[model samples]
Target: MSQMNQPDLIGIADVAAKIPAFLNKIPNLLHGLKQAYLRTPNTPTGLGMAFEKAVLRNPDGNALLFEEQRYSYAHLNAWANQIAHFYLSLGAQKGDVVAVMIENRPELIATVIGLAKIGVTIALLNTSQVGKVLAHSINLVKPFAVIAGEECRVALDEIRHELAIAAGHFHWFADQDTQTDAGQAPEGFVNLAEKIDLFPKFNPSTTGSVQGKDGLFYIYTSGTTGLPKAVIFSNGRWTLAYGTYGHVLNLNQEDVMYCTLPLYHATGMVVCWCGVIAGSSALAIRRKFSTSSFWKDVKKFDASAIGYVGELCRYLMDAPPSEQEHGHRVTKMIGNGMRPNIWDKFKARFGIKEVLELYASSEGNVGFSNVFNFDNTVGFSPTPYAIIEFDKERNEPVRDTKGHCKRVKKGETGLLIGKITRRSPFDGYTDPEKNKSVIMTDVFTKGDAYFNTGDLVRDIGFRHAQFVDRLGDTFRWKGENVSTTEVENMLTEYDKIVEAVVYGVEIPNTNGRAGMAAITLQPGSELNEQDLKQMVSTFKQCLPAYAIPVFLRIQQQVETTGTFKYQKNQLKEQAFDPQKTDERLLVLLPNATEYCELTQEIFNNIQAYQYRF
Candidate 1:
């Protein structure tokens, strides 16, 4: 980390220069803040209300653009209305959860909004999930029915028997525009599109009856300990995001935002989409991110803004220069994980004027938005928060004699916690036990409680903080949280592996840690070439692509503590260094299908950023 490579410090004067622009937003910001807090448990306002307002304001405007397909606000709204009416006819009621697994497309958006209008909580299943992971998520909520697109039918069918919902309740929508092209529905699944074709295309009367306290979404997160846990994202909490980050982006009707991130994530589904509705702006989306197709899409859509995460930016930075990269209408970018190292570099390279880098979790109470356009910080949080001293070895926050968590000095790194109150409430995971683990009580007072973010951040001046790293068993890679326990469970499940320990290790010039696993073979098992490749295939099937380990080490036996916890800290320090350990190391380099021997030269190349993993 050389001084020349470091990002420029944001000074008081630099912040002062942005006051005029920020002041201009005070009117909308204040209104948004008011809307956020005032929408109480019983208030008849939520995502559906916000979206309907957008439609009223700009019915004919381009509301969505997916590749070559275009959808006006009126057209999209009608589709959602039809969905809501048809679901209501099926006896779908408020508080009844419905699991929907659709890839990034208009169908997904319409389904979410339609369900919300009728007060049906939608459980947005991650498109990447398959087998046990997918079944676990769907079963956890015990949804009334499961609605999946054609793209996800196979995965859903594989887990149908394991799901709590009955077989006949499954509904399927074709991947294409089902209204125009009604693809054949597979056996045992209802054709949702064809059934809803004649449904009235008007706002559901139930929209006005939907209360804020009612559940809106069940977003699943891979917990630090086990399989994914469903988080209760109530309509009341939805207002917090819609009113805050929504207004912060300040897009207009004419501005088009291009988003390539997965819609299942909060950043894409909530933050980015909220902003579009707030300003009646158009949002362009891709089925999946392809660096090769990014700039062309931006140019094609004439996007005024783009959505991103740190890893997406790194890919663009790593790509070779092209003519299409220059002279695009992408003046503003919004998202999170824009690290300090490439903060300015990305902006300059892409010619972006504003980067609304934000900090938030799917279920966390607090959030940080770069409203002031800070260069390297996650920006200031308006809600009550603390960056307290954390003891790494003990894995807890440091407490004083009076038993209050001590806050770190300004500009020092510490654990981030958000105070739970009426305004900033922790919706928490569906599992009450899991909720208990993250809620820290008696912090600075006997009755106070704070939601532990399980992340470390540096408290820069003026209430701003820079994200440092994730703590405990969870690590972020490729903008997705990789659960070490989950990965370890998958690895050890293999018959040839006796035991497995997983952790995250830093790679030079990467936004987050790359997954690494250390394992011991079975008594009779040998680390043969066939078995090594088989391990790769096993992981690909069991785990999401991002959760697959990029590095592996064959250990005599996994070291553990007296309490039987794996000594992951020691292995993390040793990492993939061939010189530090006598054991064999294997790597799944970028774009390589199989793991290969990590020779000294190969390790050097990785260190020098020759491999982009």
Candidate 2:
């Protein structure tokens, strides 16, 4: 729906005709603009402040919607206050961590706001994470207590036992029943619905309150490979996200934001919740994302906007052009990672007029939102954004003798880095050492520091930045980060597997990239599908769901450099098909656990839509 590139608009005559003249005039028009209108800074000081302001301004407005159930500003605030009072009764004080694990539900938002109101830090646990990984993530936060769903209670129980976290640490809320109101009362665990009625009346006070610099939440984001990193998200950053989406994007009160994505994700928390907090209605889906059901829900809810990552958009695009695609009330969308090739088609097909593409991080302070609703580019930001050339093989920037890092020229791809200063601070993880690892000091000169984004960006110029790819070995798969080293480590533990090199391979009709592993086995070891399946099952139990590899390759010996670095470029190019390379390859079929030899027939079927991932 945004501006289109010439080549991308070629098939659409109307769009193509306007491209040439538009391109020539756009740069000057943008350059001619003064700093007045476009110079808005990042989000405000705190999520609590934003919520208070919104509640005060629009107390009767609809705040959230789950199925047919709706919560107005008064209701949301009341529920949050009750939870805050309950936490206070439990000896919770400022800066105390309260872990929350739930799917997309009203309770999740209530608990977060409630905890924040009383200065309790919310630790967001990803629902997709289960078994050992989930347990590990919980332990990493070391929260005083966890507020989880009854549906999730079973998983949390399993995780609680595995991690040796105390059973009493859990506070469960039943999310399935909407008709049954569990009013504020002491139950087995606090019933979120019940707490609303019992919670004390709102008494706005600034004394003993959480502030801009205080921790708003802790989110465990995907690391390169291994356990996830618990990134500290301060209230200031949350305020910024709220301001960017609610004000900068100009979300109206009539807007209904349908949030099908998991609430723990950065996109959902900021893009989805921020809009709702600004007095717009929010439509939440409790179940897993289904492309077939997506349009139905949008129409049913009369959603005017939707939040997405690239994968979600592609799924919608693949669902045969339906009248419902453009028939819905949706006019605009805001999210990250829309691939350039499919950008125009996705926008037009969906009838989205403005794709407010953005670039940001859950832990980072610097972020960019498409206020101008530009195309291809993730728009632009007033913050300092730089793209510097990086050598993938060496895994370091190519610096000059003067020790100043060079920026990528226009249209060139490089590692993206953001200046880390007092104002644009990188308030990193709780672990100082872990924080130090991502921060690069003495970049341009002595004492200068920058936050390593760990992403590759292309400089399109004109103050615009385009997401090219991710740097290093970590790749995003289905909106989750898949660490190559973590996958390789899990694979190599198998007795038959001597070594493994993991990397992302381009898959047809997918978001980010699909994970594939090239493995070498011990001498004389036969590549058995049964054994491979067992290993994969072990991985499923031990690792997070997103970390599992989709494709596998068996080789006699992995190609490596003299410095013992695995050569992944060639392996990534080969992918999983047997015809692509002589190396024996196998893939985990659609619902099957065991891997099967990648035959040309099966491979073609996969490419031609015979198999569904």
Candidate 3:
């Protein structure tokens, strides 16, 4: 958007429109903020306190809704309490890390809260992780114990020898709800379901002592070095999200929030789930996101709110329109990664009243929320943050001679950096050296530091901004920035393409890398002559000449991380090399109107600069 148009996106009236609700919520919001910032060991708001509040509010009311099960606040709380007492009996102590690996279910939520209530830092291992990655994540934290679902038993067994914990430390919960029928436990594994059955159903006394600074969960994120890094998410930070986003949702106990996203991710567990707990409402969960069963489950639960990521919205939009989709009670959505292109379309199609698209990182301090119900914005940060000029090619900030980074003007793009303070603390990676690499000291002044977000954002007016791209995924090309999102967006618009992952690939002797895309096509679609021509034509018509992907790799599916984020590093490493990958490669040559199969001869010529991109 232009400078003249930027002001129209959000203004004084927009903020004023939300003031009435804001005024009504002043006391609660203030209390939440106080709990978030104050470093109190007792009475510090955390997961245990928050859930207890909901349980006390209405114990008989629905707290969780899963397949064929409606666990009341009282029931879930009691179950969690029993689990807590059982672990406590086993000498579990506060501040001890307990690694948990479970798929999305009520069991997962209850298990985490149970341990968290006792002040144990839950190391949330991604369920999709297997073998080496799974073993590595567990050993990274060196947890005191392991609690896993029967579904994950094979994976745990595969890497059992690699783990540091003794065989007796492993506890198993049946894949099905183990409450009614304590299912058989795997050999040598303690049956948590059967063992905890005899424990008392009362809140642990240690709940009050979980300080604000205490680690709540350790979430693993992809690292620059190709391994996963454990990021600390403190009770303080989680409370900040709880108080901030929970109020933004403005849900009541009557509401139901449906979340199908992975629980291991912060977006679902901390953000969406907290919103439910904050409202003292029911949280309806699914094993996984399913387009076919989404509306069916929504109607079944009468869900008033839903959770989403960018791709989830797109998938829903693409699914055949059904009577079940529209006229539902789902009036709100809360999650990040909803692109500007689909923001309005998603709302209009689903009759959604609010799209609370937010931006936050488990590793970073600053967070942005869509407070004013603005469109296509990541909203504003209550904490201090700056968008500064950066060098994309050099992959660093462009600092002035005075040793201060320059802030981008409104309607300009720049790297986002959040100033670190007690209020906005960057509880970065567990690796101290890794943390040092991201913290920029002396950024704007002699005695200041800022956390690099590794993101490119375009500033709109009124403290709001639009997400541009991940700094690493975007590359400088032909003296211009080529974001993968830009190319990916254009490519996915084609009818044949189901998903597109774009990245920059180096050509021999080139000043900047050229654009390449790995695309997964629709079912029954093939890379035939006519389709290739139309795809190239669409690229020529819709995208910039330089932005057009010079190379294409046809893939059956795109690999994604546990959080549904594209695993681009692997794709970027492989590039479009025919020799490196057995997958078919195609290229659009100089002045070509259609894409053709890339052979060894064509690949060598391109490397030799026989054809210019």
Local distance difference test scores for all models: 0.88, 0.72, 0.83
lDDT of 3 at 357: 91
lDDT of 3 by residue, 508-548 (tens): 64445688999999998887889779988877655546678
* Per-residue lDDT of 189 in model 1: 98
Candidate 2 TM-score versus the reference: 0.87
Candidate 1 local lDDT, 1-613, one digit each (tens): 4322334445587779989878977888887889998877889988898889999999999999986789999999999999999989989999999999999998898899999999999999999898888998998898999999999999888879888787778999998977679798989999988888989998989998888888999988877766888888988878888899988888889999899999988889888988899989998999999999899999999999888999999999889999999999888888999878888888888899888999999889989999998788888899999999998888889999999999887667899999999878898888888889899999999999999999999887678889888888888899898788889888876788888888899999998999999988988667887876888888888899999999999888766557344367778899999999999899999887788999999999989998888
Candidate 2 global lDDT: 0.72
Which structure among the candidates has the greatest lDDT?
1
Clashing pairs in 1: none
The local lDDT score (0 to 100) that residue 378 gets in candidate 3 is 91
Poorest 10 consecutive residues by lDDT, candidate 3:
473-482
Q: What TM-score, over all chains together, does every model reach? A: 0.97, 0.87, 0.79
- Model 2, 190-235: lDDT tens digits are 4555544555757435313666667888987766646677888877
Model 1: how far residue 601 lies from native, Å = 1.2
Between candidates 2 and 3, the one scoring higher on lDDT is 3
State candidate 1's TM-score: 0.97
Measured by TM-score, the strongest candidate is: 1
* TM-score winner between candidates 1 and 2: 1
Q: What are the root-mean-square deviations of the candidates from the true structure over C-alphas? A: 2.2, 5.4, 10.8
